[model samples]
Target chain A: MTDAELLASCHTVFPGHKARTPAQMFAAMGAWCEEHGVAHDVYGSGALLQQFEQKIAALLGFESAVFCISGTMAQVTALRLACDDRASRLVALHPTSHILVHEKSNYQLLGHFDALQAGDRHRPWSVDDLAAIPDRLGAVAMEVPMREIGGQNPSWAELEAIKAHCRQRGAHLHMDGARLWEAAAGFKRTPRDVAAGFDSAYVSLYKGIGGLGGALLAGNGPFVARAAEWFRRQGGNVIHRSPYVVAAAMQFDQRLAAMPGYFARTEWLYGELRAHPLIKPNPAAPQANMLHLHLPVSRERALGIRNHLAAQHGIWLFSRASHAALEGTSVVEIYVGDNLLDMPDGAVREALTLFSSALAA
Target chain B: MTDAELLASCHTVFPGHKARTPAQMFAAMGAWCEEHGVAHDVYGSGALLQQFEQKIAALLGFESAVFCISGTMAQVTALRLACDDRASRLVALHPTSHILVHEKSNYQLLGHFDALQAGDRHRPWSVDDLAAIPDRLGAVAMEVPMREIGGQNPSWAELEAIKAHCRQRGAHLHMDGARLWEAAAGFKRTPRDVAAGFDSAYVSLYKGIGGLGGALLAGNGPFVARAAEWFRRQGGNVIHRSPYVVAAAMQFDQRLAAMPGYFARTEWLYGELRAHPLIKPNPAAPQANMLHLHLPVSRERALGIRNHLAAQHGIWLFSRASHAALEGTSVVEIYVGDNLLDMPDGAVREALTLFSSALAA
Candidate 1:
């Protein structure tokens, strides 16, 4: 079956899904375009894009914002702009930041930026880690809810301290705020307030909004203007960004308003999952709308159980199971989204019971 | 009125417009999605993208292709792969290459690739230019129908010599094939024949195809595969590219077939314009689907005439008037497209009369 058909066929309860069904996503985008009476962006900027950028910039309390094709471009381009003409193009971040692990070392390979790894693997970068960096850095990059490690984040005060240190040291601070929507909800602060700690921030449009993929790099006007140039050089300046921009604008409000609810449900669901004998919640309590669920089952058994759940009950769960698979433990990453919200009460308990029985098979 | 309404009202000829109406584009995309029975790409690869990539790779006679958000990313990423493990990250190209003039020096700034000028300002790079570089290099980038100099390109033999020189010197050859579709018809070469000269080539989707924006970096399997990883890190690995990919697929065949027709139309249009007392073709002969129409008029009056054409006769023409505007010479760049072909017979003569009258204003 086609991917769209497959996704539509399964009744999924996974939070990591950043998009709805393809048909639904496009339909809503078409509707949004009609209602706004706006044209698609020509080359990264137009009425639809301008409005989208303004809304995001205002939400994050930045002077300006530039839309890009992906968060990788946004972050790299932002850091590149930050390092412009600096004697040192050094940056420090948690070792697991997307650039370090997922980007194929582009910061060093393509961007020629040196990265200093800081902080422990299991936790967010602390103020002590920031203080430990001896050199003057071009920028300090941080990700909220550090997805690699169970969506845990530093307390707001801690994050603020890190921000202050970067400022005091003449280093530009950037936020890899791909999931800042959740961070804001978790910290109970406005997005602007959460983002105020950084000189610039890269917030994702696709993840929180659950729309077509794109990102916004926000900073001061000159910085954004410069980043816009880099955006083009780097190919992030796309033509006809209507689907990404308009649909993102449409979903922004609904998703932003729903973040607190998602956060609360995350806590509730984690609480529910913890009672299971074979299940354990990393972080125990979610800092945001996603966490990791470790189960005493093999990866093969977890895959069998997930497939069984989808086939028998029409319910799709996490994408895959990991975490010490050789030791017969299955780790599933859970993202709290509308999928989880759509589940009925005690649905998780029933699904876990089935999962428990399938582990033996 | 909105930009869409304004564009709808205009009945003029211009270059650089590839998108039809936003509604039409999305409708075509939606239709393609339905026919293909697939969804948009999630993160750079999926059913829709694979089909899109395969079609371009086959058309260009390359072993593989990776879709990117724009030509800049495709070129830079392609070169990084080309320059892999090389001591020299230096490239030689036309002095007016897009990355040099438009990218704010991103190849040097972000990509760390030093560039050396290798061609005359007014012509394509020749074997002499390659010999003049006087050093080992990473790659040699050449634009087909170099847009800045009124869409002029060297004969196939000249290009072959340059390609041979690069190969002889152990340097990679790259093509900024943004207008390769136009160039193929102009040179009476197959797309594959044109692309075969380069180790890696970046062809644009939105230009000739008249589709939503995206680009393809085409090369051998491993080069494109490595470029795909770089693509993700560079932020070109976006989610939900169905609208761009499918709409482009819809446009590709028809547009590719129409290039020769467009080239002939460009000659006809340029011939007609040359008969005007005040108008002159920059190259004196059409090289591709586009050319520069230089006029002995001020930029303001040229703009006024264009606006008059749109306001009075509903014709949209040219993006801007430049080339010594202060010296009262307005150069209007023209591209032959379906929009130009849709005009009535002898329409150019009639439009010139109106343009002359408007210039008098």
Candidate 2:
């Protein structure tokens, strides 16, 4: 059978979350809107989106918030405004930051910001790294639970020191908090607690929330007002944003409440896998709901084992494996969410054990 | 009662189209996706959006097409690409173009292009208007049936001459074809015929097709590939675009076929209104499925009459009136869509006659 057919037939998938079909998502959004008597937005203004934005702002301890079509637009607009306010076009980012890796250098190309690499790719930036930046920066962006090196975050004290350093340098501290929800759970702090000192923070609505897709950028009132203008300039201001707004509104609370559970599950799963000789997880422990598992096997062999598990064991694991930092090994990221939580106890561990044996063989 | 309560209670709305509640839009999208067995798109890829883009590209007689979240992004990206290709930052726009009037100067602030005014704001630009621009432009953007000027398009010969002028000046001719369907009906031409010779064109899927908001940019292969990159850079590349693609696909052909009828009704209605005193259309003729009615009444009086018609006559006409160029006159735009065409014969003319008499009083 084809890989897609095999995946479709799997009884359980140990990835980020249970994937909902598009039709199911739409139906759920419709039901929620009917129950709530939701109103449609016009060019990003309406009771639904405004109320949601306010709720998010309150949750994140901000004076205001604006919803955008994507996290890319929200963060870029935030950085652009920060840079414009400081009259310096320079910003500092980690080498593995989403702006540096995923966005095709739009922060430099479209936003016209000169970017300085602030830290190494394999670890989260510390206060010492922030002090080493030579230029007078307009802004410094930090991604909580940096995803590239497998969901590792700096200590709370480090984050605070970085914030203080930005204040001393007169640079805005912007949080690329796309996974801030997960990181907050790991820190045993509320989202507002984690977000308190940043000038601006952008959080993805769909990543952990399991909504359709959108983002929220939160800051003080004037900063958010500027973000609204940049939102329009970026074409994030569509005539009707009701679908995304409603989907996010419906799922946000429940999913956010479940983050701690997901994080706990990640810790358990990481512990179970770490006992196996063939598996080595980045960061050595779980800091969030996601991590990378490095296996001493070629990517092709890892894929074959994953496919074998899906076909014979009815368990879906990693989609693809990439080359790891070390020689002759491949790494796959496993993000624990509702999918892992919903699975019966020991099922995931057993499947991983089998896969590990196959890798060793 | 509030204006919204009154509007919600009305059976007819004669502006652009009947407003769909957010729930209804979602339900319709769900139904369409179910019938089509549509697959979801990821980051603007997948068969659903790909097939729709190819269909639009073929219809517009272009080598390829890219879908964007808004017409603003499509147009801006297209212009940015054209300017980059020519190694020049200068482009030309009409005084009342959406890029200038609506987008808050993003092309200048974000795209960093120098924009020169190409024509007057009160009318469609002609070939002489194109010739009058003194700069060696990177691109020239023209709106088909310019909406700000009451949906008036230049003659075919003038359009052809403008194309020739752009060619001689070595500038890319871009069409802001938001209402190209309506303009094609007025020109007695196919959409492909109307779009011929333009280096790139942007069309609004939601404007005429009655979809949830999205847009398409059509051009040759390399230009379109560049547009996709720009789409991602601008954050117009969202994760799940299936709802918009399915909605637009479901309605495109039917609405496109209905444009000629809508245009014909506009012509007949224009004739009936012009016969009455105190009412004058901008072009003195209906060029497409929309026109602006210049009434010899103050804006307040026009709104009062519109409310009277809505409350007493049960007919929804213009929502608001703007101050016309002439003293003591106001202009309201009437766009003929499915809502207008669904009305009984002469009903619109009779209501408009009452409005004219009210103005005369």
Candidate 3:
């Protein structure tokens, strides 16, 4: 099939927001390959390493940045580096972090790490929540805008209190910033301001920026430098990775800069959804470009609506599987990004209308 | 700069050969992406695990296949799976295997496997060479057409003997077939035939097939199934790596079938190189598209010749660095593949003419 056909199919499947198309991704990569020169470092910034990292660091207000192949790798590697061979292999984290579900226990199996479940996977943790953990942990990893819990984020006050708790315990604070860009808008703070609380942050260029693939781990010079070495050691370094590198840079420069607009659009969309009788946003107020949509229909009915929206309506909506996995929930996350920003409010309203109609049928 | 400009510059850098122009690489990738799907798989084949694995297995004559983002990951993971709590953690390999130099001792670190050096880094290992080692080994990994050693491959007589040696010791055999396509031509064998003696094999789709990026690991069903689980545990499984998956399949069907022609051309070129007084081909018989050119010039002078060939002659050639790292004489490997096959014999002859002229200058 042509790219147009593939994208059309994806639109039917994912609706509103979709992954970056290969053309856009390749264009992003081509730019990086032209400017960089490298003779020594295997995973150095000279390739996609520099452009994606530079753009994200500047966007996130980081001192330096390193890129890895996955959000999982970035998070686990950053946490392992932060622990620095300490006595505690225990990491305090929300029950629903990617490390627990998606990462297949590399932290324990490979890095000898265990999670001290400190907060609700779906709720933001407060100082009391952190202090509630009886174990002395080496580090605290908090996901900004917890994904498993419907992208809910705690208030800035709660964030600071958690930071203070980490300070009191002398535990390192790390941010699972996979969707941090969306959270940055929710907090009404710059990416850098949100990043200030953590010893290291991982920002995914693909999810937020719509690049083809890749993620960045950012922190102070020593931490980032050490991470770069580890990246090589993990074989994250490949010959001529400039293509993926450039794709991230392009997404950052072209798409990431428009994030605030994405926030505005998401706000408008969220407000409309919450006002509807059948549709409700979890936490009511979204912390980022994503929120949970709760349907009164059974899980099967919700999936039917989701399929109708894709197959006939040419719209994509995600619904939670009725089954339980890690954190155990049936609420699906609705994400809005730069792609959906251009979509008309009517289309958003119509999608909800279709969902309601499907439930009625 | 645009991708077109990047391709143009790359063409100017390595003019006149059958080598892939950046245009060809991107064009081939475009075809692959459109035909397949281009989601970046975290595990290498990323999202579409089954079909990708099937295609890879078919390409290399394996019962099953798995994908990895790098050869290092493939080798390390394969070794780890092969070890399976065995007391011996030793992997017998040529001194110049990628695991030794390119990888940061990941076998030792991740796989916990020690290297039992079998031959000189610049030479292929014979059955006796491997037998010379007295210690028991868990597995033996061989690079068919070892890349670092000028893609030199052992003779079939020696290969059977090495296989016998590994079997007698009950050691698993693994082939690092990263550039096995070139070696296939050198050996005048199909990929499966060249891989026949090994317990498992890895073949890179991106190197010769010219996809965006990916690698394939294949073996018996049980081993591949275990590797698949490890791939997910390692966070190699991306949500949607269909584009690379589909593209690799198309390239495997199209380019891999044409490898024999590549071999035929390489044979012709080997004869031409051997006739030249200024250059001597390693192994002299030419087992693959790769050959070491022994220039009488100093290491510095050889680099100058390479640069002159690239800049002035638009002919890309590589030169080995001095034994500063390993205490050996300098040698450079010239790789001929899709790019070199198209160049006229006169052009290659002319490029060497320029090489000889540069040496005089």
Highest TM-score model number: 2
DockQ of the candidate models in sequence: 0.56, 0.68, 0.31
Residue pairs with backbone overlap in model 1: A15-A335, B11-B314, B11-B315, B11-B316, B12-B315, B12-B316, B13-B316
lDDT of 1 by residue, B222-245 (tens): 898887777777777787777677
Off by more than 4 A, model 2 = A1-5, B1-3
lDDT of 2 by residue, B60-179 (tens): 999999888999988888888899889988888898899998998888788657788877777788888888877778999999989888888888999888888999899999999999
Q: Is candidate 1 or candidate 2 better by TM-score?
A: 2
TM-score of chain B of each: 0.93, 0.96, 0.85
Query: Taking the tens digit of each residue's C-alpha lDDT, what string does model 1 give over A252-357?
Result: 8888899998888887887677556576777777788988877778777777677667777866677767756358886888788887776776776677667666
DockQ winner: 2
Candidate 2 residue pairs in backbone clash: none
DockQ of candidate model 1: 0.56
Give model 2's TM-score versus the native structure: 0.97
lDDT of each: 0.78, 0.85, 0.68
